[model samples]
Target: MSLRTLMLICALALPAWAHAAAPKPLYRDPVMDGAADVSIVFDKGRREWVMFYTNRRATQKDPDPADVAWVHATPIGMATSKDGLAWRYGGLAKFPAQCTGQTLWAPELYQEGGVYHMWLTVVPGVFHRWGEPGATARIVHLTSKDLKAWACGDTPDLGSDRVIDASVAKVGDRYRLWYKDERRGSRIVAVESPDLVHWRPLGDGPVVDMAAEGPKVFRFKDRWWMVADAWKGLIVLRSDDAKTWTLQESRLLEQPGRQPTDTAKGQHPDVVVNGGRAFLYYFVHQSNEPQAKADPYYGQRTVIQVAEIKEDGGVLSVDREAPVEQGLVAPK
Candidate 1:
């Protein structure tokens, strides 16, 4: 069947989504929701790719537990793809039973020194809570040699009220982190570490005027560039030192009329440069369902997509198949 035909059949077969949201079509296959933002990486040995994101609910069974309270319970989940097209859900990448199943939000996975490391915004309970204040929010992470045996690692303290949405990139021998620093009043900040274990702030922040959340950094065509999702669909910025950045573009890759709350919220993008293709992975909400009188974020799920960039500066953008409501795409 053709891709559109397959999608039509898939839509026909899909159940009436209960919440107030519908998932926007992002990547092909492995239905992408609006809550799970993805990061992609290539596996040379396996000849495939991997994507990591926040899981939220487990298998849609037992529900979110927070359904009673109407909040987002985001745990970490993963997905894998062979040709960057068809994907399969791997489910629950790594969770700490200690957090009591609370949530692992905004995770960024990167291969550092032949090892795969993932860091996420972690909370303290088995269920989800909102507006918990700063002191409780911390960045949780994991490190693995094989990507299969994902062992929980140290929790880095960036801020308390809102320590969330972390992005990692390797610049030379050192690996740098671009994350939201709540202490600085919700701005995109950069920090560097010789060892991924201990990180120190590089100084103030990369963006001072705007609420710079979900900062993703990568080098395209020899120049360092950054992507973030705030009020629009994937904002772009560039910096020579990872400190001072200039806005290149905002809402550049848009899927119009998707979400009521965020009409152009195709943000939280992470890019992986492989074979001259910089796959910029991002997520958004599809608001096409009946409005709920109760929870506003109820229909909110994650949809993963990619915008390709070439070494010679060619931009290629494509939306993949949607994931099962909040289902994640793991690594192959």
Candidate 2:
């Protein structure tokens, strides 16, 4: 072939690469044998991405099956990443006296008025068993100027006793808190506050009809999006007024084929939107591969992971199989 023709063919073959390299999304926490229910936020003061999750005590054995062991009380886990793809364990998050030794579940984080706000699920006593008929839990709010030293002792119980997995967002002049109130159903409900302190119900009904938990809300593409954990997978909803929501046909992170450890479904996701792009963060159960005679890392473990989110025809989706390499753009 002529030199000019050869050059032309090569350029045409790799045209896309010339513009931008393909994304290779690779991020998973290996430090802890058990890490689940992940939330990621960019700290401007620290200039790093921080991930908070349930730092499960993997060594403590459960009388129940290992599959259900994540239910036990765990200190909130913390990890930081320079870029979105790779992460290092930072250690367990320190809570104030009120939260000390308290079993924590999903952590919802937000920053406003130069202060960091965290809404966490608190179980006062032993987490003998998950969904124990008489077990009670509540959502508490704590604020810190810096994430490290939290002013914790006070318990601002945001109403119902059986509520958990709080996801809050500031909308215009008020803050809206969405959580799963188990007493009503496993369905998610909403309460709004003008100052993030005193909260009142937005309506008398569940935001979602399905039995779901861990509802996370964020604004993207001039609209608000909410993704909730339904135990089966993630259910997506979109809202214009932030009060009334319409369910979308798509369910995200339901399959396990593309992930490194394709053993269990992705649960309790927190979506971070930065620089006009969205990313989904969640944790997967460690694989059930039998441990060999020599290998010790085998068996069940949970690790945090992230995947780039895509939007099509006003619907959002995440590809667990696609490689995501670029760091998430920090929110302005």
Q: Give the per-residue lDDT digits (tens) of candidate 1, residues 169-265.
A: 7777887887886666677887788888788887754464677677888887767877776655566777676667777543455565343433434
For model 1, the superposed segments whose C-alpha errors exceed 4 Å read: 1-24, 27-35, 57-71, 96-101, 126-130, 133-135, 159-161, 254-264, 289-298, 309-332
- Whole-structure CA lDDT of model 1: 0.60
| lDDT string, candidate 2, 266-310, tens digits | 778888887778888776765533342234334346666667788
Top model by TM-score, which number?
2
How high is the lDDT of residue 46 in model 1?
A: 64
The deviation in Å at residue 231 for candidate 1 is 2.1
lDDT of each: 0.60, 0.74
